[model samples]
Target: MADVEEMLDQAREMPYGEARSILLEQALKAAAHDRELAFEVRLELTEAYQYGAEPAKSFATFSRSVAEYDADPGRWSDWHTYSLLWQFKWIASDMRRFPEIPLQRAYDALEEMERRYTQAGYGSHAIHTQRTYVAEHIGDRAAADEWFHRWQTTPRDDMSDCEGCDPSGKVWHLAWMGRDEEAIELAAPVVAGHLTCHVQPQGILSNLLLPYVRTGRLEAAAAAHLRAYRLVQGDANYVDDFGDHMEFCALTGNETRGLEILQRELPLLDRSPTPSDRMHFAGCAALLLRRLEDLGHGGLTVRRDGSDVPLDRLRAELESDARDLAARFDARNGTGEQTRRLEARLAAEPLVEHLPLTPHARRVAIPVTQPVAPPPPPAPPSCSTWPRRPGGAATSTPPSPRGSVTTPSAARRTGGARTRSGWRPSWKASRRRPCGCGSARPSCTGRRATRCGGRSRSAGSACSPRTWLWWRRPTGGCSRTATRAGAAARCPAWPRPTRGPAGPRKRSPRSRARRRARCCHCWPSCRSTSPSRWRRPARPGRR
Candidate 1:
């Protein structure tokens, strides 16, 4: 049993019970009353338990193994200590909340593992990394940070090159501490740099990106995700079973992409035998659908637990899918026409639900309008050409770029004018006001002006008669022009509120009406004039 190579060969070919019995007997005999035998038997039993589904038996044997070693110090060996420490992590993970031991004992066990690793000289990096992780989780931030620094500062030994001992844990620890941005930057050169590949590029990226997401750096997370995607290279088993690609996609608000990947992997899950493997796919699918519902993406209906999903019109599509599955089986003994009919039915299944478009979903799907190039900033208002003093209005013919207009005081003031072509609010505009109507607006105490619902409405306000325009149009009824004209006629000499320097800036009649109706609703007053209200403060004293 202590001859690991020979025993492993036989175990590979033998049934579980037979293999366990042979390994147990030989492991016990190898040391003949030595504490080393006790440790060996424990390791052998623990290995068997790890691969088997019987937790009770596995833990029972493991506890017994620990007891035997405790009873005899002479039997302990460096090999036993190292193997036991490694297995301890697995046992702790599986047996969480079992209450067979206290939490402190688990900590003690991990500390013991650190001691064992130090004694072994090799695997010190692995133990250090694992200890840091446990400390971090157990709320010992001081201990965790200390271990983390050691992991970062200490030089790696040859054993640190092992895939299992890679600095993945340390990188993850850094990420968990709200240092994800730093962690990513640190890991980047290492992961992409050849000298850093020794750190296990794929595994570190997989663990590090998870924190990047929580920190609101989705772009960085996406970069890491691309690396993971590249690593899988589109292997269905790796994507569905090992990589959790679908869950990753769905949780991160990329449902459509995730579902596409899942559909591709579904066939593999259908054939997978291992319960754990099957559960990974099934559980991820279920969670993803739930997330879609949470995001309000599910159609009129949603499926849960074990029911058909809530995809509204997609119910028929699912039934069609089921029918297609049955027909494929039925066609095993049927004619070609049967197969053709099945294929046709399956092909007819709709790829997406027939839900009404949601404002949010539509917004997400809609292409964003980009800013058009702004016309060159109006040449700085030059005092030399002004017909009046620098502080006074021009009284003479204004200078024009092409000298087209000769009218005195007729020059449009482009000094603060935003280009109508690209109407984004200028940094000055934002900084100049706290977002009320621009300077041209009147005080609340000014005379009331009836306007259309759209123009004056505050966000989410209800419309009322006060906000409705009193003017009626010709028999064709009020048009956009009629609405604008009616409001302007009712409120003469007032500047139409502009939407910053943007193009064709005006509130719709509906918003104006809503605004009038909600007058006493205590809406947030747009500050348009507060000196510091602007998004960016105007250059001091120059305005």
Candidate 2:
């Protein structure tokens, strides 16, 4: 029989997947005769299973370690025991991903961790942090808020996540609260090249990408994507990170860049063992591919499994896969939170008109308002179009210039939609307020009101507000002057607050009244509609 130490070393050298998992399994069996060795082998095996191709098995491995430690506490060292406790969070989080596991099981896992931590004289920081994740996961905002506060107030101990990870968690929660400004502010310390770690800058940078874009920090957003993606690439543990980068590219008019990211990451999709990571990756891939299709690149193909797969087919497969996985998560959680969040992600608009990316990108400024470029004259006969890869290689046509954005018409050009200011919060999108295009929003089957509800009221439906596409119109009865006026619906191109926690958060009465007073109630039934009457939103403080 192979020495367990030798087997574990071999497994570590191997890449993360079924093969590595199998090797660790064998080593676990070999170490079973030696209780101390078995505990050591069990801890290592759990980490492999947690990140390898079969993540569900990790919990099973973790379970055995716990039973052994409890059964003979004198046999295990403090190092082995602490190692097992640290993994409690991993089990708690991943258990919620599968539909088969009841949510109660996840909470039980957390309670177990808390009990053990308290017995060991550890601080409550890690326990409260995990409780926050559980509450937030199930869409229980009040409970999540209470837990988050406790997590914040509890002092860190030997068991809390490293300096990098703790702050990264805070950044994500802040972004979730729809406080992009605060999220970015909190991330500055990590982003300033201080306190770096494998997870630090990557985790911090990915969380801030969309926040920076939504706040008109286009250059910062671009820089973040480039910096963060490099760290996460090719790591099985960073599957969630890859999905975030893909979503960033899709939202920043970098579909081609997204395609490049897709080509690199798609092959590793099956290698990822966690259901939640796979779900996130599929959803983001579908988002990027949808943008490609919208830009007339539906015919384009990506190389997969030694053959080219058309992106349209790829998009359909990913969307179905995402929804299916989301359904499973929703079934388990019973709140439909994952499903609703996925739909929001699929429906979000770009935050930037044409923000550049990476080392090769050029500085592009988005004006508050610019002359609508006249639709280019019909392509001259023989002016053929070609699909160009980000590396400057052309796949098809001969006449088009290199590095051109693949948009169809000036009016419908992908990425042409621009925000008026940095204020396209997705609450407006979630409201599904009707655009003047006269096309009724389909998802909003809710009972339509004959009179516009303005901002605070909703009729009969749970359907979403609308897509990223919308047009603006000017109205006269508005208390706020018509700069980015309420006469028309907002654009679908603006970045909606997808991960922010505060999207559907309840508003204060004073804030609610303030929102009501800003717009006219002339939508869906107003007879007056004219472009000539439209005016640019007033510059702040301008008379």
TM-score of every candidate: 0.39, 0.64
Model 2, range 126-225, lDDT digits (tens) per residue? 9888888777777787888798788888889999998878888888877887889988887887899777674679889999988998899988988888
Model 2, runs deviating above 4 Å: 5-23, 51-54, 358-543
The whole-model lDDT of each prediction reads: 0.46, 0.69
Instruction: Judging by TM-score against the true structure, name the best candidate.
Output: 2
Candidate 2, residue 507: lDDT: 52
Task: Give the per-residue Cα lDDT of candidate 1 at 452.
Answer: 33
lDDT string for model 1 (309-414, tens) is: 4453343443344355334433432334333433343233222332112224321331234588978865433223212234666443222221110111111222
Candidate 2's clash total is 15
